[model samples]
Target chain A: MNEQMTQKPYVIGLDLGGTNSVFGIVDARGDIKATTAIKTGGHTTPESYVDACMEVLLPVIEQVGGLDKIKAMGIGAPNGNYYNGTIEFAPNLPWAHDTVVPLAQMFSERLGGIPVGLTNDANAAAMGEMVYGVARGMKDFIVITLGTGVGSGIVVNGQVVYGHDGFAGELGHVTMVRGAEGRLCGCGRTGCLETYCSATGVARTARELLQNTDRPSLLRELDTESITSLDVSIAAEKGDELAKEIYDFTGKMLGEACADFAAFSSPEAFIFFGGMTKAGELIMKPIREAYEAHVMKPFRGKAQFLVSGLDGASAAVLGASAIGWELK
Target chain B: MNEQMTQKPYVIGLDLGGTNSVFGIVDARGDIKATTAIKTGGHTTPESYVDACMEVLLPVIEQVGGLDKIKAMGIGAPNGNYYNGTIEFAPNLPWAHDTVVPLAQMFSERLGGIPVGLTNDANAAAMGEMVYGVARGMKDFIVITLGTGVGSGIVVNGQVVYGHDGFAGELGHVTMVRGAEGRLCGCGRTGCLETYCSATGVARTARELLQNTDRPSLLRELDTESITSLDVSIAAEKGDELAKEIYDFTGKMLGEACADFAAFSSPEAFIFFGGMTKAGELIMKPIREAYEAHVMKPFRGKAQFLVSGLDGASAAVLGASAIGWELK
Candidate 1:
């Protein structure tokens, strides 16, 4: 639409995770012209974190013909607030855990005042899917990221729901189980969906099953404390009965939860992201079966559940960069 | 904004409940200029029901000068679908129970081709609140109606969430308790919020509490089968401990449910409507307290809990009429 927009064919995307901050200079087609990463938790303060980020990012910017070739930058981080372009009290971010960091503004100032946008990682993934991945052309759908924690990005009437506090899509925290017997969650809640459906939750479930039942499985060979979702997947692939049951349990809860979610926004599809989706049909089959069985009558058989279409390695960075395309 | 809009200064609001179809001709200020009603279940056919409605409506149409003075019509009915302007499978509507009635189109055809709109009662009430009640200027809020059944109208980013289907805001049916011990709901589900928080649910709670405990109260004088929510409210007002405890249980479940709803939309307010809200602080205090106690840390104390400000007698009709104002 503009001369500069056509001339500047790339935008910067920063996927700021607890372990690493990945930087990608992406073209409009989702092609990563250049990419780099730096350890995130090494910085003692927000200011120092941004300083370290710039050192790595400057070279990537130069690789893509300098800052002028980039239209804007988008950051996907834990607790990133789209409305204010700040990361607020993100527990896993060392520099932002206790204080709200105006990371977008700081980056914008250093990058010659180009527009910068920010949102939580899940929402960024939703934007990515909408822009160049599976959710393209879909006006309404939900992107669910099932990693160590479960996160959601809800789209209604073609826009992501940021809500009143810019933190609306916290579906993982919605109470799946109601009382004392429900598992304790990281948020200090009991019986949250994250307590049962997240990747870590799957491992936890595997541990519980291994101890509670005597069914022989490959998982029992591993040290119980060190069990991971990957181990469970491997066992399930090998037709381990206990591991399959664990997936059944996990997928049942996820499907049941999606049924409830349908009652809320009734999206056209539900896109799954993160490590848990990698279990493929072992996980998806039960999710579909449970969703059909549990969904309200009007919504039965209406929503499609699918895994993310983006490349797993670059998906986070692409998702973060997708936010840049919409920055004004 | 137009000559005809100024000339036709009124719209028709029909609150089509199971027992009564209350119709009102309202002006821009929510003033009822003319009103009428018809028994909803008296007719054996949808056509006859519309005939009965037209017979009474003609007089009101004349009383308001003429049909030319009315700009549009809106119906707030059980199972009303906004997208199609139809009442689909309304179980309590005797003539329309198993059929989809093009009620809005029928009204439009009968009223000199005037435009008409229809939506479920809760969504109508939400529109009413936005246009003429306490929710004025609010972009995001949830209106929960606790009557014979519980219903909700969810607003996000200034629009009522119609979802993929017209039936989006069914918060009444969201599962609160998820096991065999949970109450069975009219929707054939167990442990729905409606089974615990509706006016009928309040009576059910009263029966459960009275039968299970030996606590003395004014409600003991009444037959358990015939005890109404009104009786419980009166007993609670009279300082009956058991009655208060019933409110506490009902309020606690409702508060917890609202906390979950917050995870969906993070609404700025939760507006209460219908007969149960008449309990005033008896119910409101507990709902507010529990919401604050249970909501996510980011959302705690941020959302205001309030009662609907519309006059109870005209609220439903006003709500329906509000939809008329938006009809194209």
Candidate 2:
């Protein structure tokens, strides 16, 4: 075998989301040479989902010079376990909802024994940031993904922290509130950071505020039960008092949580990812202010607050592919 | 030089505290061959304090076959910085309270230029456990020190996480309760875990419980203003209901904190150290119960709760000495 031919110049990324399995062939510089997608939840089983994925993915791989030119594949999925390369009990995925799917091995086998790596999506984002985004050259930092659920990827001494069971850095689940009166989380717990800082959490807060107050605002024009974070952002953009207050409350809690996280790892930076960051200074200002106010004296003013530098459309796929580059 | 002489068989340990500085010469098996002590806060200057420490430590070093037999030295002190080997702004140490002291370098210079390492006491305990006690062969664990102030040392992937600024693992300061009604901590924070679970916090709990409730207990006979954790332990031993309740509150908070910690590192064990662990099952049971009750689903039933296996009198010294072994 020629060493040059075997040293593949590209890798594949699979961003396995609840609704879409987005695939991209990426190079060392994070360029997407070819991309494709499949409906993730439409498949009846894990095997069928992989079959559908391969059908869409094959042409994309061919566009990038076929199998010999692809070094590996990496998947970023909900409940993905890096150690075993399995997707376990991912509630949002129809194919992997109730059982552990050996997705990495399946992909590897179907791809002529090419190596495949898997990890929770947030960790992938962290790896992406380190490889090609804002967190480049940082040895210790945390990447927070704020979407339907809040997620975190922690880096320490330049390596992702995967604790004893291949499951660590679940910062979103840390209780931000203790005792009976706290908000209930989907994780069967009360007062998780996810309950207060997630995109869903923001909508929940908006609904609560809308129902509890008599204030006239742009959000009142929308159906309160169907309100989304996008709606909140639009409302806030129109200078709605109530919507702005909601961001304030959300950002404050998130900043406080980051303060606690600082006490844990003392990262050089905290990189925020996902839709909520699109709110920009409206959200970022409050997060930075609250973090500085709540963090311990030694840690205050030391950590940078950054947004994901990767292009929003391609970041997740790029992140997954970055993990592919790390495969041994 | 002969390899035997260059690879000296002993290490020196300094357990520098607010009130006293304890020194020990230890062999490879964690045995304390000789020991000495000196007043820590008595000196008006760091120079005088080092002078007093050396006055007592030299004889002990001589008894262990002189400085030539010592490979390195490690100091576990308040505000000790592992990267710089200095004590920085330690409020309890008179000489080090307002300034950073290069104690490690001073010791090395005075003691024939042997390598010296230093870190906060809790980190030292973690090193001790990894080298000579219960945490042997474990790559991920946390050691919580429950003394006048609560402190922590977090190990992930077989290395202590020092963070970006060498002040990570300040778990005691993480908020247990949010908002106005929480207790004030010495660090000027409110609702810190140290405010609820430290040895001092135990005494404070006893005072509050005694003052708030009218129920009669053996603690009422003691001067409330002067009560100590030892008093609470004694009362609990005699089956005092109020004292037992105090342990329940402290242990529950600690357990809950450990649960949060699990979310961070998913450590295999949570080890308790310091005077409070001496209460044994009185404290351990509540911590275990609360941890099991509050830990996230993935982490539940996965961690062990343990007390320090090293002897109380020598553990701190042993822990400090273990860091010496890691010195290059």
Best by TM-score: 2
Query: What tens-digit string does per-residue lDDT give for candidate 2 at B144-244?
Result: 99999899999999998999888998999999988898899998889999999999999999999999999888999999999999899999999999999
Where model 2 places Cα greater than 4 Å from the true spot, the runs are: A1-7, B1-6, B51-68
What is the alpha-carbon lDDT for the whole of candidate 2?
A: 0.92
Q: Flag regions of model 1 displaced more than 4 Å.
A: A1-9, A62-69, B1-8, B44-48, B51-71, B112-114
Local accuracy of candidate 2 as per-residue lDDT tens digits, A1-328: 8666567889999999887889999999898999999888778888998899889888988887889999889899889999999999988887788999999999999999999999999999999999889998899999999999999999999989889998998999999988897799988999899998999999999999989889988998999999999899888998998999999999999999999999999999999999999999889999999999988888989999999999999999999999999888
Instruction: Give a tens-digit lDDT track for model 1, residues A73-106.
Output: 9999999999999999988887889998999999
Q: Please give the DockQ score of every candidate, comma-separated.
A: 0.68, 0.82
Say which docking band candidate 2 falls in: high
How far in Å is the alpha carbon of A249 misplaced in model 2? 0.7
Question: Which residue pairs in candidate 2 collide?
Answer: none
**What TM-score, to 2 decimals, does candidate 1 have?**
0.94
